[model samples]
Target chain A: MELWFSEDFSGGSRFGARVTQVVASHKSEFQQIDILATEVFGKMLVIDGKVQACEMDEFVYHEMLTHPALLSHPNPRKVLVAGGGDGGTVRECLKHSCVQEVTLVEIDRMVIELCQTHMPGLASRLSEDSRVRVAPDDASKIIQQARNMDVILVDSSDPVGPSEALFQPEFFQELHTALSEDGITCLQAGSPFLGPEQVVKMALDLKKFFPVVHLLTIPVPSYPGGTWCLALASKADWNPRGDSGQLIRQRFQDRGLTDQTKYLTKDMLGPCFEVPAFLMSIFRREQQAVAR
Target chain B: MELWFSEDFSGGSRFGARVTQVVASHKSEFQQIDILATEVFGKMLVIDGKVQACEMDEFVYHEMLTHPALLSHPNPRKVLVAGGGDGGTVRECLKHSCVQEVTLVEIDRMVIELCQTHMPGLASRLSEDSRVRVAPDDASKIIQQARNMDVILVDSSDPVGPSEALFQPEFFQELHTALSEDGITCLQAGSPFLGPEQVVKMALDLKKFFPVVHLLTIPVPSYPGGTWCLALASKADWNPRGDSGQLIRQRFQDRGLTDQTKYLTKDMLGPCFEVPAFLMSIFRREQQAVAR
Candidate 1:
């Protein structure tokens, strides 16, 4: 029952929490990951002592990370997902009939194995789909070699530890090169409340390389502040996922899939782009500072 | 700056911030209203020791309170506002040409005065309208005696403190007696976040009095949580307000009022009703509870 860290989403900042106990721990090659699975927010996935997702509400992140760009491409025949070893992104991509192939480039093969073992509900979907391809290799180089990917989803961790290069401009440049003319990509941007300036920096930088950039919002109960941001980049005016002629609704096909959601909503697709005013203002002020 | 209370809107009820220092304070007959307009999604409007509004962003409590019910009634020559003396409700009501008279029956008159003095930007256009009237009267009694009112806005504080009775079935009955047969009414039901139970209670009770009962949402900067809920009731079916053609696009008709607003979009009227899954579940649960 120990609280390790807390963040304020209203204004992006973190504070130390009183730690009660360490329920479970695992040391990954990159960082120490733990599964606190607190009673308050269902199961919590903590990585490097920071909350990564809550089982009860991780769908928001998984849906936003996978949906928008997947649906936007006219016909996404091939897809590449960087760093989402959890298999949630690939699971969502499998719903789209247009996606014929999906290659998940993840450096940490252990993460996938752990999820497939520890969290079967999420991992089961990956094994059920034949289109999914797992490449336990460095994503930075893997993305450079890939081509003809109509959609690319960069579902990386934060800009720290092994995920450091994922937030850099150079990695984004490679993502841009790897994407086809119609390719769309999304990145897991940090919380805009506590770390808004950083979110804005990435947003502005990404906008430079892509014609359309959108910041999607999702409420992740176990994250620093229970809020997370996803940065989406596309070469065309990409329509958000879920608005595709009720395609997801009609084709979800699985009666079980339709019932197990606590977070993903059809209406939430666009409003996630409706950034709070103060954050928008901060982004504006940041832009002003950069201009000077 | 003492941290009183802070609440995060990420998921569940985990994020809350309470400050010992009075961010904004006002003496009223009911009690002293204080505000801690945080840097969060919405400005947290704390009255006395409770949250009234949060301006960090998301949700539209302000627009829903003033627009729909106000626009529904044809040629609303006289208007009565049960609460919302802070002037935001009144400001939106003044946009309609048919609104010849408006009586703001706020129990805590000081909240209005303090709002006028401190937040002049929100209150500026409100009192200046010759058609508007400010009455520091007990709303329950005043509504019984009031007549010829085309629309009544129960823009009171939460059903806590002095405004507790405002949410009861009896109060809505009084509101029904006060308005004309075709008149409409809207009230600030607490956010589906903090008070989904209350929303269902009010919706059911209001349905007993008014023929039409519907719930709407708007984002306000001065509430406890980021999102807020507003209940809409009328003698007629609750339809979209924009179809009536009395929508307030920009704050006030004058172009001079543009610079002060933090957020309120013209196209954002109906889309505000999009509630997240967690809140919607509460509403559905409340509905089932009442049915039992």
Candidate 2:
């Protein structure tokens, strides 16, 4: 018999790898977490039956999530990652020389524990890094405390269960209040194909606080739709697209990221702002519907 | 029992939507074909057990296939499509009023007939369009006839089964010999992730004949590797990146394609050239191993 592990997306579609071995499986208080040794994706982390990250392609999502926000900010020293238990986001954040402190607030501690045991490259830094701090707590509450952050990266899952609160407008308001005056926060919005309305709504929610809101579409093949969005909101009046993103390019090169980065480069900043045409059409249709 | 239709990639990974109904299933001399009503992707066309196009996201794949090549060419009046049984490519090609004739050569006539019966939006143009000429013939043989196509799009499946011949180096020579001196040809060159080595080798093969060969990455969520590569080759000395693809923008405006296209925009021309980070790294590693 063939062993196939498929995650049912919205009870509609499913995508998963054939498992040679189920490395780890547990039912935490919050969700179900599993580590699978697969043939295609090296080692995959699954939470609540949703594929979180794979060893081979995790760099793409992590680098895309962190570098653009960090580089766009003039100085990103204190970074807060919400729901990134795998520690990939923290690892990317720690790449920047300016980043002095990183606080990872995940809803589930079992996720970090599993990663540290099974996936060393992703979770080892969460423990060994001197500048890092791990807080196994709810992110919305943490953001409500209004601790100033230079950058906040919402590395949450799809808008369901624990992550549903993260997509609400109230959570967005908290994120805005928690960030510094000139700060930038980028969060993983839902898939445009899977939840276009929610994706648009989440972006609109951010607009309630920040004048500058840009949705960067990044390819995450393991995810349900493979293409997902990262909503970047900034309190500053500055535009990310200014000077054809020369600032991002200059900063990326000056920071010696060209040699270090696997996926993101100085050349990629321009395309980061492009929304897929279908998504644009969805926005246009919704504009006729939504007042904002 | 719940029915699931998955296309296994290299027998290592799989991606599929749950089948609500089997609309059409046939075994032609060329390959197996199944039309499925899926819960997530709507009506999906499957060939040789591989998902080809879905009612929902086929636009993303078809638009990406047709627009860039047609727009980049000085005046793409005559176009040739190889192995595009689902008439989506023809629909996209005919969208350009400049195109005078479209010749669709396919190895399997049954696939076209099946699509014509079920997928009206995708296949109706084949029977109705005045300019479109549906040729139930081998694409390789058709290309060998030196058709002098201004733009040639190979809308074939993965380099396997009947579509295998379309990916050979000799086939690249035939494609070059068939095109005009200033012609532009774009072909789906398999997934960068599923078959990175094949992707690199295919791009290199195109370089043997054309001075300008670019690999454009597009997302097709239904496909095994949601992200795939399109190799666009040009006989002319011009780069598509000239003036940030201002030509495409001007042509889009002049041609009034701004109102018609769902996916490819003038703004997307810059990104049409941006290779995914992992793919770029793969290319770098391959360059170290393969000599020109």
Candidate 3:
């Protein structure tokens, strides 16, 4: 007998992986989570029937999500990760030597526990790092008290159900309030091809609170669309394209984190911000709407 | 009842689209071709059980494959499209005002005929354009006698079975001889993530014939691995990054092709060449092998 795991995107498109067996399945108060061992993608994590991450390409997502924003800030000492129950964001955050503390606020303790047990490659650092702290609470509420944060990484799921509040305008406003003067915030923006309107909506909302707002795309095979996006917002003028190569290399060297990364590099800083013409048009239309 | 079409990538990963109905299915002299009207992707062309192009994201593939090489050349008057039976490449090449003639050499006549009837949106220009000349023959044989071509776009399928000859060292050498002194040749190099060795092998082979060989990647949803790469080779010092903004805009204006394009633009030329660091490392290793 052959078993398969599939996820349907916004349209009628679907992606599937051949599964060997279901490792774990549980329904937390928030969502349904399933862990499966797959033939191609190794261990797979599915949340509410959506493939969150697979072992094959999870590094691309975790590296891209954490590195760019963290490197942009001059010194990201106090980092707050919201909704990253997988612990990949915290693992990446702990890589930086300048990072003194990493506060992970996840509403579901079950996600953290399950991931720590099943997906050790991603969640191992959560338990190993002395500087890491886990808070089982709502991310939006936690951000209210998160002051003096140098970097805030909202590694949340899609904007639906419990995670919808994370993408709201009020949450963005609270994120701005929580950040230090020169801090930066990074959040997962949906695929431009799959959910163009949703991505544009988030960018427009971020524009209200941030002086510098940039969108970057990376290829994540497990995602709905092959291409996934990230939105970085900062109080100061922080352009990812303007990232200094020498400084990035020096930081990596100082942290002893040069060989640990699989995808993130100083050379990728500029290219990641190259939004295609179709996506650029979406942003242009949003700008026109604001002008009107 | 529901119908579905699926394609498997290198690492046992698969993508499926729900089909409304199968429009056409035939076995030509070369390969099995199927055309389906998908629920979301509209008309999809499948060759040998592999999804060649879907109506939804075909523009992204055709536009990215043709425009970059054509725009980089000083004067692309004569163009050759090999194995583009669906006629999407011919359609894009016809958009350039400077392109006086487009010679499309396809191995399968049935693929063209069915596409012309079923996928009119893609193959319409092949019959309508006086500049296009269709030759139902093997691309390898046709290129042997070809000469003085400004741009040669090998819009062939994967390097397997009937299309395997397109990626041979001799085919690349013929492509080099057939090009004008300052001409450019673009061919679909397989996905770096899925078929890394295949991509590396092709890059190394092309390095021997062309003075300048560059690889660019685009998000092609229909193709295997989601992110597909194109290898562009030139005899002259034709750097896509060196393409001037004024020239691209002027060409667009003179051609009266500004609004018709969905993806290609002047800004995309430079960033497209900005390959990821992971891919750069592969090239680096190949270079080290060459050095040794």
Candidate 4:
């Protein structure tokens, strides 16, 4: 008999993998965190029974989450990441020399400790840098302390428990206040296939603050859905997927990050902004309903 | 108690869903076929214990498979679909008013019969049209019988059992022989994450017979890995994702298929061809080593 880890979705669908060993399991003040070694995904970090990050594919999620916003921003010196205990987002943010400071406001410190202990590849960046600070406090409160942040990334988990507040309109209002006039906000918006309505709702909420909002689809196989949607919002004329490949390449070269990336490329920038045709019509219908 | 249908991948990963009801189970001469009413996917067709097509997301796969090949062609009048018993590919083929005739060559008549019965949304277009001819025969043999075809779509399962031959050089050679000078060939290449080497291997083999070979990724969340690949091969000076959105939209209008598509869109055509940056480097490394 083989050991397995499975999570059932609202649609009664499941995404799971076989486990080889249970590295560590801890009950934090907020949620349960576990470290498991898996056959394919390598060291797996599980928080509240959800797979947070695995060695095999964290690059795709982390790269998509971090690089798009950072690379597209004109000068991202001050960064605020809410609830990415895995530190993958911070690791990508640290790649940019333009980033002078990073404030990681995660409510669960136990989750960060476990990731640092096991998933060092993702979680080690914060400790090595002098510019980084870990708040380990509730983001809704800590976000108020952040003012004029050049880039704000909400790497929160699903909209449940501690994260439910992060999805509310009040939080969007806070994020808007925390950012500079030209600041950009990017977050894991949800699955377009599973909950396009929720994604649209989040985008509409952000639209109340930001002038430009774009939803991007990234391949995150470990998620309940095979793909995840990310929303990019900004007050300036910042286009996520509108840049040409040559322009994107120039940004990478100018930033000295051409070869530093593993997943993001000049070709990937524009393509991700495309809403699939099936979802395009769905998005229009939802937006129209919300508009009324 | 909940009844679940689980399939384990070679990488120790699993993708399964709860079954509301197992509508039909048949052991055909070639493989085991199952029609299941799934909670989220609506109805699903499983072959050899692998999730083949589900009603909820089949449009993404079929539209990506059919429209790109049909639209890019200057004039796709004679279309040949190899192993698409689900008729989703056939249905998409019929959408193009440019396609005067479509030959659906599926080996399993039972699979076709089952699909026609249970997945009418995917399989009903055949009987409704006089242009379609159902050839329930082996693809390797039937492919040789076809010539001067404008477009050939291979809607095959995993390269195992009955579909294994579809990935061979001999079959690709036959596809080369059975095409008009400008004929294009598109097939369901394997998962880029799971079997990228196989995708590259098939593309390299086709490069022997065709001047251009492009592998495009499609989102098929029902599959183990949320995404799958499709390879486009042509002897003419053709490109799968080289055209602009305006050009792709023009193709749709010219073919009179603007309103017929559910997933394929002007914006979607170029994006799917972006070999993700991680996969892009791997593809190049493989191609360079092969070049030596």
Candidate 5:
């Protein structure tokens, strides 16, 4: 059996088709979330005919969010994942044997339940992890009083609708107070290639609250234009080249991590951060134009 | 007054505005080409609302194509460039004072006139080069009988409507016969990210004719996905690492040949060839599936 999902990314239109046998089909409260766990690739979470998440390309997002922060901090024993109900990020965090605890604060508990029930390939392994706890609650208010965390990952949806608060500077201020001095955070900062404005805006906002802010990019097939960006920030001076002690280079076939990754790789690390000169020049021109 | 024209490449659609004075507009025979010679980014060539070529970014493509061949051979004094009528390739070839002559075979005279008439920034530089001789002829038939050439560069359009012959296996066979024993050639293979199949086909076809076939990638904002691949082939084993002698390494920039580039850099070379795991597995599976 086979199935094909088409996303008219240029016009933001989506359509799906059943090429083979249908495993499951339904509608959820958030949107028409359909789970099609394929044998070739992994589980795929589709909403409104557009692919919300696919297991095959999820590692690009999960690794970019987790690895930068985990490697930045000296020791990351305790971690917090804000809004990743799919368990993919949690699964990646649990890979670190040094990490003893992980708390996933997702506002929509239904996303977690749907993923667990329909997309087992994505959320199944996390259910067996003893050090992980899935907490269903408002992430902004929940992290207001939290403290002593090594890393906090904001795996929220886009900046509108239910995830609007996640993109605000106030939410970042809350995250600023809820972490230890050595704490770091990485969040998906939209598409740098297609949405350069969003990247510049997010980097500017995070720079106001954090001492260091940098942007990274990764290519995913399911995503529009096949490229996306991740914003990394910390409360200390951060340089990817400067940090040497805690080296965490990700590869596809790393024993336990092998079965988890579909697209993330070690060779792709440096190129992901290499922004094109044309885009960088636009950013500079806009900055100088605005100053005048 | 200095004039500058910039193309808004924010999304899939590209639109160019006249930043200086409103210029005349007309259609060309080769394609719907628009020439906007500017002061900042050099001459801009617009085709079908897409930036076909810009003087600033053209150097990266021409340098990668010319240097690898000229450097690989002991002393490449004779060169032939197929379809690079803009004379960008000829200009780069002229850099080697050792080169006595360069033959530029272009199919369309319109392209040459367009550059000469409007794009003085690109064309004026070529008029001064007495070594370059512009021959109006079909490149496929032009290279067949040619002999004793130290280097031949197939700088044609993509393998579609007008360039279907360029990608054919027969053209590569003729190219193989035209070069000397140690002679080399480099063709612009399309984006590996979006056109993986095209790159693989070219690699396999070139391998049948040449002993050493290496694929190099450079990022170009005008191209789809900001990635471009180059296919190099020679009768002998041409190793870029081995060829980095004192002569070449001295000119080699820390960031690849990016000073002459707007996008292609040293950091972006390897990742351009690194296909996603799922894509690799699919390629492997298809090969295996076809063999069975």
Candidate 6:
């Protein structure tokens, strides 16, 4: 018998993978989580029926999510990762030698435990790194108390259920307060194709708190629309594209982080900021609406 | 009762869309063509069980495929579209007022007839434009006989079945012969994520004839890896990035082609040439291999 794990990625589109075996399944206080061994994506991590990360292409998503934000900041000493329980974000964060303290505020300890046990490649860094701190609590509450964060990476799921609050303006305002003077915040904005309005809203909301706001895109096939957006909002001017190739290459060399990356690189910095014309139009329209 | 259309996108992955209704299905002399009204992607056109075009995000693929090459050339008057039976590529080609003639060399007439009838938005331009000439024949043979073409867009399927010859080195050589002195050719080089070797092979093969070969990426959700690559090969020393903003804007104004495009814009010209680092590494590796 053939078993397939299918995700209904809204608008009646479904992406499915042949499941070899169910590795782990559990229902935590917040959401249901499952880890399945898939024929294509290798070990798959599913939370609330949504594919969070798969072994095959997880590096692309993780590297893109973490490195760009980390590298943008001159010295990301104290990094705070909100809502990344699987430790993939933390793993990428630890790659930087300048990152002295890595604090991961996860709502559920179950996700961290499960992933650490099942997906060691992603979650092993959680326990191995002496500088890492895994806080088993609400990110919204944690951000309120947290201060002096050099870089904040909101590695959350889609804006639904628990993550819905994370997308609100209040949450962003609190995040703004928690950040240091030169700190930059990178959050997973929804797909421009599937959820244009949502991405526009996020960009608009982010612009209110931070002076420099930019949307970078990367292809994550497991995601709803294949293309995913990352919103970089900074108190200080941090244009990723403005970084010189020599500086970026030197920084990568300094951190000893070149070999660890699969997708994120100094060369990719310029292209990542290249938003499609259609998506740019959406942002323009939103700005016009706000201006009116 | 519910119906669905699924394509196994190789590497043990499957993408399925809920079928609202079947628009058209036929077996031409070339391949099996199917048009279905999909819940997510609007109308989807499938050839040989592979998705060639879909209504919803077709503009992204079509615009990315055509514009970069067209805009790179100083003045592109004669454009040849090989294997774009659906006419989507032809529609994009017509957007540039500078394009005086567009000859579509398709292998099957049935694919055009079906798309023209069922998918009018894409195929209607074939009949509406007086400059378009549909030649229902083999692209390989047609390309060899043709000459003085400013831009040649190969909108063929995967390097399989009838479209396999289009990826051959000999075919590329013939395409080189057909082009004008400062001509450019843009072909859909498969996804770098799913089939890196195939993309590398294509890039290496194209480099044999063309002096300047560049690979650009766009997020195409319907395609195999979600992210698709387009290879731009030019005989001239034209770099898409080197084009000034004023020049691009002026060119857009000259052509009166600003409103028709949903994705391509003057601003996107620079970023399109910024390839992913992983892909750049592949090209570097291939170059080293060739050097040895």
The backbone clash count of each candidate, in order, is 52, 0, 0, 0, 0, 0
Backbone clashes in model 4, listed as residue pairs:
none
Docking class of 2: medium
Q: What is model 4's native contact fraction? A: 0.70
Q: How does candidate 5 score on lDDT? A: 0.67
Better of 1 and 5 by DockQ: 1
DockQ per candidate = 0.21, 0.68, 0.55, 0.72, 0.18, 0.61
Better candidate by lDDT, 4 or 6: 6
In Å, what is the interface RMSD of model 4? 1.4
Model 1 scores a TM of: 0.76
Per-residue lDDT of A146-222 in model 6, one digit per residue for the tens? 89899999999888988888999999999999999999899999888878888989989998899988888888887
lDDT of 1 by residue, A171-288 (tens): 8888888888878888888865556788888999998899888776555544554456788898876444335425534333322234344554555444456654456677789889
| Model 3 lDDT tens row, A1-292 | 8788888886578898888999999999989999999987889988999888788888888888888788778889999999989888898888888899999999999989999999999998998989999999999999998898999999999889889999999999999999999989999999877787889889889999999888888888778768888998989874544545346545655666666787766556666777777888888988998899
lDDT of 4 by residue, A1-292 (tens): 7899987888578988889999999998998888999886788888788887888778888888887777767789999999999999999999888899999989999888888988899999879999899997999898877789989899988899899998988988889899998888898899887777788888888888888888888777788778888988887875544453346556777887776777677667778778777677776887788779
Q: Kindly report, for each predicted structure in the order presented, the TM-score of its chain A compared with the true chain A.
A: 0.83, 0.96, 0.96, 0.96, 0.84, 0.97
Ranking by DockQ: 4, 2, 6, 3, 1, 5
Q: Write the per-residue lDDT of candidate 5 for residues A65-184, one digit (tens) a residue.
A: 786577667668989999878888898888766788999998766678888887665677657888988888878878896898888999887776567898889988888888888788
Give the alpha carbon lDDT tens digit for every residue of B1-292 in model 6.
Answer: 7797888866467788889999899998878999999988989999988999999899988988888788778899999999988999999889887789999999999999999999999999999999999999999999999999999999989999999999999999999999999999999999877788788889889989999888888888888768898888999875554554346556766777676788776656666667666777887888898899
Question: In model 5, which runs have C-alpha deviations exceeding 4 angstroms?
Answer: A1-51, A72-75, A117-119, A236-238, A242-246, A250-260, A283-292, B1-136, B146-165, B168-184, B188-198, B204-212, B216-230, B233-260, B266-292
Q: Which stretches of candidate 4 lie over 4 Å from their true place?
A: A240-249, B240-246
Q: Model 2's DockQ?
A: 0.68
| TM-scores for the candidates | 0.76, 0.97, 0.93, 0.97, 0.69, 0.94
Fraction of native contacts under 8 Å reproduced by each candidate? 0.15, 0.59, 0.57, 0.70, 0.22, 0.67
Candidate 1 whole-model C-alpha lDDT, 0 to 1: 0.66
Give the alpha carbon lDDT tens digit for every residue of B91-186 in model 2: 999989899999999889999999999999899999898999989998999899956789999999877788889999999999999999889899
Ranking under lDDT, best-scoring first? 6, 2, 3, 4, 5, 1
- lDDT score for candidate 2 against the true structure: 0.86
